[model samples]
Target: MKHIAKVVELVESKKDDYIALANDIWSLAEMRYAEFESAERHASAIEAAGFTVTRGVAGMPTAFMAQAGRGGPVIGFLGEYDALAGLNQESGATACRPAADAANGNGHGCGHHLLGTASHLAAVVARDYFAAHGIEATVRFYGCPAEEAAAGKTFMARAGLFDDLDVALCWHPSVANSVFMNATLANVQAYFRFHGKASHAALAPHLGRSALDAAELMNIGVNYLREHMPDQARVHFAYINSGGISTNVVPAHAETLYTIRARTSPEAIDLFERVKQIAEGAALMTGTRVEMVFDKACSNVLHNDTLDAVLDRNMHAIGGMNVTANEVAFATEIQKTINPDDLANASRHFAAALRDPRPIIPEILPYRPDVERPVTGSTDVGDVSWAAPTTQCLTACYAWGTGFHSWQMVSQGKLSLAHKGMLLAAKTLAATGIDLVGQPATLRAAREELHRKRGLKPYQCPIPGDVTPPPARAAGTPAARASQDVIA
Candidate 1:
C-alpha cells in the first residue's frame, strides 16, 4: 500500500515508451527462440533501470533474466515475446492485411509483445517502488522465449531457474480481464519419423516399402484411438515430411509431429505412449523403422488459491479499462472479421462475467475459484506453475471474440486499446508485487498452498533429461528451409 500510488504513477508516466517497446517487438515479429533483438530491447531497458541482466539463461540465446533490489522475497515476473509464423497483419487494420515488409511472415498474434512489455514494466515499477521506500525485496523479469510452440519455460524449469522464486506472476493479453483460475491441459510434443527402402513405383512396386504409407497409417490409427480417449483429451498431428513430391517413386522417409494432451502430466504421457505404440504398429505393418523424437512437454497448471485471491483483489482495485468511441468502433470492425462461431463461444463463456455487449470487454471478469473450467489449450506457463507458486491474469487487449494466433489479433497489437490494457495489467501486477513485499504472510501462504497441493513430492519436469532445446537456425539455411515446411 505504501508504494501502490507510485507504482501506478510510474507506469502512467512511462506509458508511451512502454507502448513503443511493445510495438517495436510487434514489428520485429521474431519467431520462437529467435527473438534476439526483442530480448535485447527488454534487457537494455532493465539495465538502464539499474538492474543486473543475465543474458541467455537456460541455454537459450533468446532467454534472459533481470533483477533489481537487495536480498528479500524474490518476486519473479514472466515475460514472453515470441511471435507466430504466417500471421503478419498490418497494425490498426480491421480486415486481413498482411504486412508486405515482413521478412519472416510472423506476427504477435497472441499479443506476447504486449505481454512481455507489461510484465517488464511491472517489474521496473516494483523495483523503483521498493528502492524508494527502502523495502528489502528482489524484483525479477524473466524473458521467456518460444512459448508459442516450444515449451521454453519447461526447459527453464528443468534447468532450475524458477526453483528459487518465492512466487511468480504472469499475465496474458486477452479479450477479458480476470485472474486465470482454469487449469490448462498438459501436453507432450514429439516427431515420429518413418524410414523405409525406396524403389521405383512403376517398376519395383513389390520391393518398395513406403514410409509415407506408414505415416498415413499412424495418423489413421491415432484418429481411431481418439474415439476411445478421454473426452477432454486431444491429439493433434501435422506432416513435417511427406517423403517427396514425386509420386512415381515410393517415398523412403516421412515424418509427422504429434501433440498429445490430457488433464495431467501422467495422463498426457500415458496417451503419448499409446500413440507411440500405434506408430510402432504402423511401422511394422509397412516394414519401416519408426523413431520418436521428443520435442517438448508442459505440465497442467497448478492453482495457488492464495496468490489467486491477491491477484483478484488487485485487478478489482485497478478497475476496468476505459475505451474511447473510436476505439470501440475499431474493435467492432475487428470483431466483424472474427468467425461467428468464435464470437458465439466468447459470448457464452463470458455471459455471466460481462456487464455490457460492447466490442471491447472493459470490465474485469469476476473471479470464479469454485468453478473448474476445462481449458483445452496449453501454455509453457503451466510448467512454471509447477515450479513455483505462480499466478497469471488476463487483461482485455484485443476486441471481444478475436481469436488468438489470428490476423485479427495482430491487427490491434499496436492500438491504443492494447496499450491501455497493457498499462492496466502493469499497474495490477505492480500492486500485487508490492503487496507480496509488504505482507510476508501472503507469500508464505502462497508458498504453503503450492506445497500442500504438491505434497511431499518434488516438482517433476515433463521434458526428458536427454532432450535439449533446438538450436536457432539462420534464415535461408537448410534447417530453416526444412522448418518452413513443418507445422509446429
Candidate 2:
C-alpha cells in the first residue's frame, strides 16, 4: 500500500518525462525489429532513472534489459515498441493524413509506444520505492521490440532470460482495465517453398511443373483438415509468395506461409504434425518437392488464479479511466468515420456484455471473473508464463473495440485517455511488484497454480526444428528467420 502511494507520486512527478517518452515513441512509429529510435529512447530513459542498461541481449540488436535494486523476488515488466504498417496518421482526427515528414507508413496503431512507456514508468517507480522503503526486490524493464511479428520474447525465453524471474507482470493497451484471466492459443509458423522447372506455357507447357499448384493444394489440405480438428484448434493461412508474373508463364517457384494454432503447446504440436503430413501429401500430389522453413512459435497461456487475484487488487487500487465530455465527443466523431455495421455490432456486443453501449468506449472492468470475450490471438508471452509465474492485465488505452492496426488506435497512443490508461498500468504493475516482494506466500501459491495447469508436460516452442531468427533487411544481413513468426 505504501509502495502504491509512492509509485503514484513518482509517476505524477515524472508525468511530463513519461509523456515525452511516449509521444516520442508515437512519433517514431517504427516497425517490428526496426524500432531503433524507440528502443534508444527507452534505453536512455531507463539509464536516466538509475538502472543499469544492457543492450542487444538474445541476438536482437534493439532488444535490451534494464535492472534496478538488489535481489529478492525478481520482478519483470514486459514492454514493446513495435508499430503497425500502413497506418501513419496524425495523432488526432480520422483522416489518414501523415505527419509532415513520415507519410503513409508505420505508426503506433496498437499503442505499444504507451505500453513501453508505462512499463518503464512502473520500473522506475518500483526502483524508487525500493530505495525509499528498503524493500528487497529487483525491478527489470524488458525492452521488448517487434511484438507485431518478430517474437523477441520467444528468443529471450529460450535463452533463459526469464527463467530466474520469481514473478512476471505484463499489461497491454486495450478497450478497458481488467485483469485478463483467459487462455490464448498456442501457434506455429512456417514457409513452404515449392520448386519446379520453369517453362513457357505456349511452347514447353508439358516441361513445367507448376509450384503454385503445390501451394494451392497445401492450403486446400489445411482447409479440409479444419473440420477434423478439435473445436478449439484454429488454422489460419495466407499466400505470401506466388512466384509468378503472368498467366502465360508456368511458375517454377511458389510459397505458402501457414500458421497452425491450438489450445495448448502439446496440442499445437500434434496439429502441426498433421499439417506437415498434409503439406508433404500436397507436394507429392503436385510432383514438386517442398522446403519447409520453420519460422517462430510460442505456447498458450496457462491461467493462474493466485496471480490474477494480485493483479485484480492492483487494478482496483489504481482504479479505472472515466471518460470525460471532450473524450466522449471525440469518440463520437471517430465513431462516425467507422463503418456503420461495425459500430452497430460493437455497440450491441458492449451493451449486452459490458455496462456501456457506446462503441469505441468499453465499460469499467472489475477484479475477478474471466472475461467472456475471446482473445483470438497468440503471443510469445505464453512461453514465459509457462516457464514462470505470470499474470497479465489490460488497461483501456484506446477506444472500445477499436481493434488492432486501425487508425482509431493510432490516434490515441499518448493522448490524455491513453496516458491515463498507461498511468493506471504503471501503478498496477509497480504495486504488484511491491506485493510480490512483500508477500512470499502469494508467489508460492502462484507457482503452485502454474505447476497444476502444466501438469507433467514441459514447455515446447510451436516452431519445430531450428527456426532461425529472421534477418532484418534494414540491419543488412541476408534476411534470416529471427523475426519470421509473422504469417500475416
Candidate 3:
C-alpha cells in the first residue's frame, strides 16, 4: 500500500505532462492504422522516460512496444491511440459543432487519447517504482493501433508478441468506473467483392450481369439468416461500393463489407461460413463471381477472476475521481446535447449504483463478482485476453449520458475532468501492476484461472494463417477505398 501511495504521488506529480500529452493526441485524432503521429508521441515520451522502444511490431507500422525493467514477472499494459472516423469536433464545446477547419474529420470519440495516455503513464510509474525499490520485474507498454476498425491485437497475438507475459492490464475511458468482468463477442470482418461485365442498362441490359444485384441479393439472404442463427449472434453489412454512379450503366464491380459476431469464436466462425454460403448463392443467382477476402478476426475474452480481484482491490483503494464543481457544470452542459432516450437508459441502468442524478459520475462503481453482463461489442483486446490472463477496467472520462462515437465524447476528451479520470486510472493500473509483481502467486493464480477457463485447447489465432494484415491506406482516402477489392 505504501508503494501504491508513492506510485500515485509520482503520477500526480507528473500530471501536467501526461495531460499535455493526452491533449496533443486528442488534437491529432488519427484513424486506424494511420496513427503515425499519435504513436510517435507516445513512443517518444516513454523512451524519454528510460523505456526501450521498438517501433512497427506485428507488421503494423503504427504499432510499437516500450519496455523497462529486465528480470522477474513481465507485466504488460495495453495502450490504444486510434480514433474513430467522421467525428471531428471542437474541444470543450457544449454544442454540436465540427472542428473549425475540417467539418467531417476524424476524432477521438472513443477516448483512446486518454486511454493510451493513462496506460502509458501507468507503465512509466511501474518502471520508476521497480528502479527505485531495486525490484526485479519487467514492465512493458504496448502501443496497439487500429482497434476501432481492425483487430490489431489479434494479429499481434498471432505473431506471439504476448507469449512471455505473466499478466496484462488494460483500461478504457467510460461514463463509470468498474472492472470489466463480462465476456465480449468474437467477431470476423471481411469484404465480399462481386465481378461482372458492364454494359448499357437501357440498350443492352442482357449483355451484362449486375454485380450490384449480387451485392443486394447477398444482403437480403444474410438478413433472412437472422431468424436461423443464435439469438446472440449479430450480422451487419455496409455498402462499401455501389458499382457505379450512372443508372443507365450496368456496373461491372461492387463490394459489401460484412461483420459477424457471436458469443464464442466457434459460433462466430460457424455463422461466418453460413454467411459465406449466402454470398455464393447470391453470386450464382446474379451470374456474377464472388470473392471473400478476410480482413481481421478476434476471439472472445477469457475473463480472469484473479486479475479482476486485483484490479478491483486497487480501484477501491484509490477511491473515486475528485470532480470539481466547474467540471460538473461542464458535464451538465455536455449532457444537454445527449439524446433523451440515451439519458433515460443510462439513468435506469445506473439507478442502483448512483445515489442521485448527476451529469458527471464521481464515484467508483463496486465490483460485482456474480455479474456476467454480455458486452455485445467486439474488441481486439479479446485476443490478448485469450493469450494471457488479461483484464480491463473503465473510468469515467465522459459525461454520464454521452454516447460513444459522438461529438459529445470528442468535445470532453481534452477537458480537465477527463484528465483527472485519466490520472485516476493510471494510478489504479500502476497499483494493480505493482501488486501483481510483488506477489507471484497472484500471477500464477491468474494464469491458472485462464488455463481452467480455456480448458485443454491451446490459444488459436482466429484469422487464418495466410491472412496478413491489410496494407495501410494513404492519407485522405476513404475507408471504403482502403479496403481490399478482390474480384473473382
Candidate 4:
C-alpha cells in the first residue's frame, strides 16, 4: 500500500495527457490489423514516458510491447486499440448520427479507445512508482490489435509473449463497475469456400453443379446439427458470397463465414471439426470442392479468484465515478435511444451486481467470483488469461442500457463520463500492479491458482502453425471506406 497513493496521484496529475490520448484514438477509429496511426500514437506516448517500446510484434504490424523497470516480478497490462466497422457515429451526440468527417467507416463502439489508453496510463504510473520506490518490478504494456473481429492476443500468446509474466491485469469499458468473473465462450471462426464449374442455365442446366446450392445445403445441415450439440454450444454463419448476382448463369463459387463457440477450447475445436464434416457432406452432395480456411480463435478465460480479490480491493479503494447532473441527463437521453428489450436484457446481467436502476451506474458492484454466467461472448484477453494468471475489471463508461457495438455506445465514447470511468480503471490497475510487485506471496498465490485451474492440460494455440495473420490493408481502399448504415 506504500506506493498506491503515489501511483494514484501520478495518474491524476497526468489525467489530461491520458484523456487526450484516448480522444485521439477515438478520432482515428482504426480497424483491426490496420491500426497504424493508433499503434504509432501509443508507442510514441510510452516511449516518451521512458519505456523501451517494441513495434510490430506477434506477426501483427499494429501489435507492440512496451516495458519499464529492471527487475522483480513481471506484471503485464493488456490493451486493445481496434475499432468496430460500420459504427461511424459522432461522439457526445445523443441521437444516432455519423460524424461530419467519418474516416474509414469505423468507430470505437467497444470503448477500446479508452481501454488502450487507460491500460497505458496504468502501466506508465505503475512503472514510475516502482522505479521511484525501488520496488524492483517490470511493468509491460501489450498493445494488442484486431480484438474486435480478430483474436490478436491469441497469436501473441502463441509466440511466447506472456511466458515471463507473473500476472496480467486488464480492464474493459462496461455498463457497470465490477470484476469480470464469469467465463466466456471459446470460439473458432473460418471461411468455407465452395467451387464448381459454371454453365449457362438455359442451355445446360444439368451440366453445372451450383456452388451456391452446396453452400446453402451446408448451412441447412449445420442448423440441424445444432440440435444434437451441447446446449451451451453455438453455431452462427453468414454468406460472404452467393456465387453470382445474375440468375441466368450457373454460379461457380460461393463462400460462407462461420463462427463456432463452446465452453472450452477443446469443445469449440471439436465442434469446428463437426461443422467441417457438414461442409464436406454438402460438397459431396453437390459435386463441388470445399476449402476450409482458418480465420482465428481465442481460449476461454481462466478465472483466478486470488487475483480477482486483489482487483476488487483496488476497485473499492478507488471508489466509483462521480456523475454530475448534466452527465446523468446525457446518459438518460442515451438510454432513451435503447430498445426496451435491450434495456431488459442489460438489467438481467446487472441484477446480481446492481439494485439501483440509475442511468449511470456510479457504484462498484459486489465481487462474485463463483457465479457462472452463460457463455455468450468472447475476447482475445481470454488467451492471455490462459497464458498467465490474468484478471480483468469492468468500469462503467456508458449508460446502463447502452449495448456495445451500437451507435449509442459510440456517441458517448469521448464524454466526461467515459473519461471518469477510464481514469478510475487506471487507478485500480495501477494499484493492483503495485500490490503484485510489493507482495511476492500474493503473486505466488495467484500463479498457483492459475495452475490448479488449468490442471495438467497445457495451453494450445487454436490457430494452426501454418496460418499467419492477414496483412494490413492500404490506407486508401474501397473496403476501408465502405460504410454500413446501422442506425441502432
Q: Which runs of model 3 end up more than 4 angstroms from their true locations?
A: 101-104, 347-356, 475-488
Candidate 4 lDDT, tens digit per residue, 316-381?
888888899999999988888888898877755642545557898988988865565634489888
Off by over 4 Å in 2: 340-352, 359-363, 370-373, 456-458, 474-479, 482-488
Using all chains and alpha carbons, the TM-scores for the candidates as numbered come to 0.96, 0.92, 0.96, 0.96
TM-score of 2: 0.92
Query: What is the Å distance of residue 237 in model 3 from its true position?
Result: 0.5
Error of 4 at 262 (Å): 0.6
lDDT of residue 178 for candidate 3: 82
**TM-score, structure 1 vs. true:** 0.96
In candidate 1, where is summed lDDT lowest over 10 consecutive residues?
479-488
Task: Give the range where candidate 3 is weakest over 10 consecutive residues by summed lDDT.
Answer: 478-487
lDDT of 2 by residue, 1-488 (tens): 65566777888898888888898888888877788888999998899879999998877888999998996889999899888877887788666576666633778887899888998998888888888887788889999877775577887877778878888888888776777655588887777778777889999899988889888888899889999997678888777679767888888888877778888777887888788888788778877878777777788877777988888877777666677887777777776777767654443322124644463443446554544545457877888898788888877776666666788888777578888888888888888888778899889888788878878455555554456556454532222543332221
Model 3 TM-score relative to the real fold: 0.96
RMSD, every candidate, angstroms: 3.0, 3.2, 2.1, 4.4
Q: TM-score for model 4?
A: 0.96
